[model samples]
Target: MDLDALVARRRLGWERLRVLSRQRHLDGAQADELLDGYQRVATDLSTVRSAAPDPSLVTHLSGLLAGARLRSAGTRTFSWDMVGRFFVEDFPAALYRLRWWWILTALANVVVGLALGVWLYHHPVVENTLLSSVEVQQLVQTDFESYYSEHAASSFATLVWINNAWVAAQCIVFGVLGLPVIYVLWQNISNVAVIGSLMHQHGRADVFWGMLSPHGLLELTAIFVAAGVGLRLFWSWVAPGPRTRLSSLAHEGRTAAGVSLGLVVVLLISGLIEAFVTPSPLPTWARVGIGVLALLLFLVYVFTLGRSAVRRGITGDVDESLEAHVAPTAG
Candidate 1:
């Protein structure tokens, strides 16, 4: 029965199972079973991982590339499309779950910010704190007319073009740890609350629009996305749905990471707008148009790019020569 190989496979499966189980949506029985398997095989998988020949990661990637090539040629071999679909199914669901918790945290921050802003507005210590940071000083003290009128369109385009991708990347990359995600979520929510309070005090809601909507919102969302990626990892460990806690966390570890790629693009777009457009002389209506367009593109890419990977194809393995993704925690 090739017991050694069978055991190796089971060990690897348990590792994957540990990650998927972190979702916190699984039945008690399944969770217990997965947890047991994860513990039993973890040591063995460690050995397999360390002792295995160069770990053959390339082989897995190669197989997928080969499948893509075959599909391009319309060959009648095994259905490899499922591989991509499987990944999209899991990644998006994880992202959705992470966002939910972030929303809840954000709501709490909003209340705190409103309370603080009201207090500060009445007391008049707000601008002083901002002066502590040169960046904040620049943002707060500058006249809206000079800033927005100078080069609004170019600023808007650059900001959205660069920072949106940055947000996505951070959410994907640093999310492995719980703290990074928490920090990101907290920072964004707090800033919004603080800014809202200040604007109310100054009777400058309209003015705030020029500085904020131009690039701040998009840049902020990118940061949140970065945090979301980390939160996904954190949640997998803390909650673990239908599997054991450890098993659910393990599954998340195996996924491909692209948070850095997204981060670079996001910075370019958002940074440029923050530097140039928000302070420019563009009309309110013009700013609105740019923000709207940038947001729509983000939605379209997220919902559409992976549809081919998610919505089409069988839910299982396709052909030989290609190794199937090892199943989660087996007996």
Candidate 2:
């Protein structure tokens, strides 16, 4: 009821809280004092809001309370420093560490795609069974080429990015199953093989490569990385080595999450190339060159920066400070 008297009574406590809240470090006594001050001031503010509801007083106390609350509980504010470390250290390190998994995956997919493409090309009967003559003709003549240019570049890029990101996410999320990741890769590679064979059958091999190469190189690599990371996650638990299975899975799971985020950007670049560079009138060489450059830069970033980070003991997992403490185990 008596707002001014209450303010007079609680002013020192509020001021102490303000000072404590702004402090960079506090000893145990000061921490206790800060907590005590915060509770008293909160009560003061509540009483004022209900009895007097003085605008200025309420505003001042509210601000003080907010700061003290944040100070006491601590807040994880955004930091460009964390972001920089993530890209420069965490992401590349994870990519580098898991390079074998994805490299093998990419190689296997390529072998499958090329093998199936060759098989289908040599076997005209198989293509006929998959698609009627009319459908195959339509696909080779217009549908395949038009697919890239039919939508506006920006909208198409967005759609491609979203779709590819979802696929990458799925690979990481379903990695534990192992079989699902393989199934996804098989489905993706088979479709590409079928299309490539059909395009080659129609004597549009040049056109097919020209349209797909500009984006497919990086796009498919990102997918392979995701699939590899997923398989690694599954294997972590299956064969945890010295660590407990749960511990192994958690470590890999965190790394997998980071890889998933990094792949979003990777896929975005590929989507841009697919929507803009692929359909553009630039010579096929120039477009493919850009795609090659992008892929090379990514590889260099992983092998160079990522390898260095790994050497420095970064595993793409959260910082040790953020990780939960685990029981010590003998090697």
Candidate 3:
């Protein structure tokens, strides 16, 4: 129990831990060694604090123990480098892997919205049931368009971003339930279809298309991506393939979370357009063209850059160190 003896016995282990703590990366064996050393050093610090109470010795051991604890616990530091990697690699690769899911979701929602719009245009009664004569007229002539310009551009952008982000987040967070994803999609599409049908029946299809296209293209796409991720989570539980159901769900869940975060930026761009470009006095073609351009850029990022990332073995999931970390199996 002599403090000098104790220090002599443990000082080498503590020094090794200090060395390992400063490393940028640790091989598995080194990581294990760090953990063991961390525990021993922690005990040494406690013993020295109680038995010796030497300020300098306690301070040195405390600092070394703290660093070792961080190294052993895998502390993450936020950095511009990590941010760059996420956008350049993680986000796009996640989108690429889930491209089919989102693409299918986008296509199906668009088709349903169009079909419903067409059906409602033909069925005046249905449109009337949804909106009375006064409501319909107001919606077509003023309310629909005024809604975009009623607020300051910046405020409107923030408002739209928050609302849309909430929707997207809900789709991902509630995706495990399965039916919620379907219900969310249905609610979104139904609202658009109702509005579109009413506008078309009122002979203001031009207004509807013009106002909607300036932001709807990208906005709707982001929503579809959220829905796709959510549905995939649900399906992961239903069919995990080679992975255990929990493993499949967890992997998809992490990727889904990444997609959710990335879509926030995507939705912000769309919101800005809806607030600024959609309502500005720019020519209809110009406004729609801006929206189209934004959508095209997103598509290219997901498909083009994403494909390359995927081919490079990136799937927007956590790195192998954090994954199951298993060695490859023989087929």
Candidate 4:
């Protein structure tokens, strides 16, 4: 009940715990002693809180306990090992696990874009409504091709990376709402369709594909992956299977976060291709080949490495040690 008396009684033990916690290394016996001291001091703090109610003593004990807890638990640091594990295991495993979602998303968008391009090509009136004769001529002749080369390569790459990354992030973050992801995809695909239709109509289809195919393939795939992952996050709560809705959402959300991070690197690669390769003096075939190669490597990485990782029970989630503790439920 007496604060002063309690402090006097526990001071030696508290000091011992502090010393153990601050030690860079500890023997088994010293570790045990530290644990015992931690328990006793915790009890003392509780008693002082109820009986003595001394704020200063409470604060000191709280700080001491926090240090001890950290020492006991240890700390994780950034390392090459962590980066290797993430790309090899976590990121790809996530992509493989959710492959169907993004694949379907890619397919649907392609279909829509193609169908719209065809319709717009046939309906000259639609293009007239969207762009005047001069505007169309300018876009087909100059704007489409010049846009890529208008800026410095490094700056253009950075700009494209930021813009694409933001779009991908939005797809994941707003995926839970369902409609927003679709809206984002529609806006992207429709613009492409309109431009492609106009280019083909004006007999500049070569210019359009030659410029776009160099970076658009991988860039668009990364976006599809984000949209798919986002839709999956939304579905986690919608159809949670046997798990509670909250639990399912938490699991998928963690995976989605990892996917978002991985997409940053993917978009960066695509951005580089867009800036350097797309507008390079290289032949159109060589440029498109580079883009095709990049997409193929990404796909192979996802299917081969990702599939293997997923088979080993990696769901692209954070380490089990990092996950929140879930209460066990009986079947």
In order of lDDT, best first, we have: 4, 2, 3, 1
TM-score of model 1 relative to the true fold? 0.52
For residue 271, model 1's alpha carbon misses the true position, in angstroms, by: 3.4
> How would you order the candidates by TM-score, starting with the best?
4, 3, 2, 1
Residues 193-227, candidate 1, lDDT per residue (tens digit)?
56655555556768776567766655655565555
Which 10 residues in a row give candidate 3 its minimum summed lDDT? 322-331
Which digits, one per residue and each the tens of the lDDT, describe model 2 over residues 48-160? Answer: 76677778987788788778877887868899998898899999999999999999999999998999999989998988988898999999999999999999999999999
Q: Which structure among the candidates has the greatest TM-score?
A: 4
Please give, for residues 1-331, the per-residue lDDT of candidate 3 as tens digits.
5878877887788788899999999999999898888777767766666666778987787688667766666768799999888898899999989888889999999899889888877888977776679988898899998999999999999999999999999899999999998899999999999998887777888998999999999999999999999999999999999998998998999999899989999999999999999999999999999999999999898888788899999999987655542322223
Clash pairs for candidate 2:
none
Query: Which ten residues in a row are the worst by lDDT in model 2?
Result: 322-331
Segments of candidate 1 deviating more than 4 angstroms: 1-119, 122-174, 242-247, 253-256, 304-309, 313-330
Compose the digit string of candidate 4's lDDT tens values, residues 204-245: 999999999989999999999999999999999999999889
TM-score of each: 0.52, 0.79, 0.79, 0.81
Alpha-carbon error at 150 in model 3, in Å? 0.6
TM-score between model 2 and native: 0.79
RMSD of every candidate to native, in Å, equals 12.8, 11.5, 9.5, 6.7
- Clash number for every model? 54, 0, 0, 0
